[model samples]
Target chain A: MQMDKNSYKKYADARAKKSPCAKNCVCAFLFGGLICAIAQGLKELYMTFLKEDDAGTLVSVTLIFIAALLTGVGIFDRIAKHAGAGTLVPITGFSNAVASSALDAKGEGFVLGVGAKIFTIAGPVILYGITAGAIYGVIYYIVTLIMK
Target chain B: MENLIRIPKPVYILSSASVVGQHEKNGPLGEYFDIVGDKDDTFGCDTWEKSESEMQRLALSRALNYACMKDTDLEAILAGDLLNQCAGSSYGLVSFETPFLGLFGACSTAAEALLLSSLLCSSHMTRCAAVSSSHNASAERQFRYPLEYGGQRAPTAQWTVTGSAAFISTSCKDDFAQAAHNGEPVPVITEAVIGKSIDAGITDANNMGAAMAPAAADTLLRYFRESGMQPSDFDIIMTGDLGFEGSSILCDLTATEGLDISAVHCDGGLIIYNRETQDKHAGGSGCGCSAVVLAAQALRGIRTGQIANMLFIGTGALMNPTAIQQGASIPGIAHLIRITADIV
Candidate 1:
């Protein structure tokens, strides 16, 4: 491509040599959907032993535990490498993020290492997620009052 | 630093050596390396950073040994690495009595060291050593994530080469018949161009090749225009660690200026690893990428009479971890060094 100086970035982006492939997308879709289905199955299983809402929460806890364990055992990243976005589906992704950061920072000493750096990746998600949720709640309240 | 100009006097590379980790040892040029770290890629060190420094130390020592020289014989050691404050070079070469000059060119450290060493050898010093190293583990911990982190690297992400290469450069005018064994062909630095830092507005640290290709292109264009030399004039035109994406961009970028180097162009990043088996998506990168390839492959080729002359442009992304976190685009630089076999 005969690109001008200003268009170098566009030109470079056009030559996306190894972006996630179509196969990767399909794998992510399959893997992510499979995780959700398994979570659903776990929820139903928990429902037999607990209340309906408590079962849903228990399923989430189980998923996070599994993700953290996989990360510590050095398997989650390996799977992420091939699975691509498959492993990045919210609950699992968030768990992996926190666990990975904690593992990475553990060398510096617990107080500054694991304690301070545990939320390095997940911190931004939580901050922004809560902010957006509060804004949504306010809009929902206003909308409900106007409807009445 | 001299830019787009020939050195006042020729500097001959008498000897060189490469030390790599297990991954590079298992690479295509694996056997070409002088030494490889153990199965853990630690080189018997407790930490990855220390191992990186150790690689630099081993590289310089081996280079000196190959040249039949001693540590005291070295006038200076020009070494650098991809670490905070260039710790790899400083700590690794502390045992050497030679005066140390620490350098920081990111991935271009090796070429910058070689370029400066060549100039110093030609003018004032004799037996100047140029060493640069980068460890995958160390670089990852510092630049991206920790060793045990579970996030996947992008397909465009390049694997850092855990290796170091050292070159012994001396003035060709100096006499050294005693150390010259088997009448081996000497590798000489003929010309060099210091790269002007150029930012193509690329911010994705994972895709460094794209960020650096512009700098490589700029330097090559200058060398071609100033020296009035075509790419065909040399046996090969090589880049440091532009990897797959950067290599293609370089070819295209240069073509835009009516200079097509596709025929004679080669990349150190692509030369070191096997794409088929190794999971390195864009191939190997880092200072050691070009350093080892030049030592193990290019210099060997020069010694064996396969390549009479070649242009080596070492590309580097100059973004620090903090700068990337602040959303600053990566600015890249490529230092060019031309090497040839002595006619004698």
Candidate 2:
């Protein structure tokens, strides 16, 4: 059907109502910002609690992992709905993805469910790393042996 | 910075049904070709069982014909489509022994795949990259079922073409690298910004412009701010098919943002089919509309030195049947790619 100019104009006008506005921005700035700030605070507390030299790094990673796990419980989806990309734009989002998958699958069977599912999002990274590493290692061993 | 990398080879582009005559009949775009009568092919996606995957395979085969490496030589395949699971891309890539990464960015999937591939190449993470996109009318049938297997459409709703596009990116010594920046290759991506339109409850497909315009504006504005470049600094600013309305809305929105970008802007939907010829109501749909235009038209323009400093923005309505079923509004996203000539 040929779109008449008048109808097209009406469509265009109706469309204008759906235009993106700063008010409807989906990136939950406040909530995501609060979560990040809290995570930082928790990291500091953990570092101070542990006197070990590497405690800061260790504690931060642990906290990030735990936060990601909470996000995986499907709770983070609600938070993300409210926060839009705010929840997604952070490292915490990645954690949430992995944790959520693992939690959802945990009911299936621990080995395949909990263990395998936790790495769903990060699986590609790990797979590539291991495959590439093996290939590089084999090449290195061959080259060294031949040179000797 | 003086050394530049060229995508080592050219990738051949192939379409399943290249309706090359004005009165071509019985394809996804058969009706369109009959009306338009241009020598251009109305790539019909109407008949293909698995249109997306079929087109993807066809496109990849075409690329392989032009590429130096055999199918086995490819390290991995980066592919996507405007479908759930990126089904077309995944199923197509599955045939190859190489690993695959499925991506979805609505219409921007082609560029997204390329960008990721380029990043991997620039970082020496991969030796080669291939990116492709496809659309099939039958696939739309399974998904949208727009008209009753046969029915009339409002001019606002566009007929999705069944077509696919592919390109190969390889690392090669850059000759154009030297002349442009005195030996330094310009970055393929000087900057990139992704923006999404917040859903405002508009459902009519014709008004996609209003739904997607904000994302386009936000990204374009962000690109200017981040790159510290003005609108005129680039030769052309191309947007993925926004039809006539979205294009206007984008222009208006840009003006509101205090950025005047009227002179160097265009849209894929408006340009794909000559309105005088086909009268494609609102314009083209499906991922192939933008992908084919970028590969066949935009890249040609850049290669011949007809254009420089091109900003290609691919827009997508992040709406699904599920969302529409739930009465949720449509949210759109636009991804930008900055490509410059490697003038030797």
User: What is the lDDT, from 0 to 100, of the residue B30 in candidate 2?
Assistant: 40
* Cα lDDT tens digits for candidate 2, B270-293: 776656666466676556666666
**DockQ of model 2, rounded to 2 decimals:** 0.01
Report lDDT (Cα) of residue B145, candidate 2: 35
Give the lowest summed-lDDT range of ten residues in model 2 chain B.
B11-20
What tier of docking accuracy does candidate 2 attain? incorrect
Q: How far does residue A3 in candidate 2 sit from its true spot (Å)?
A: 29
Task: Write the residue-wise lDDT of candidate 2 on A20-117 in tens digits.
Answer: 33533634567667767876676667777776556656655775676565564435555554565566556665566566555545545789867876
Candidate 1 lDDT score relative to the true structure: 0.88
Supply the TM-score for candidate 1: 0.91
Chain A TM-score of model 2 comes to 0.52
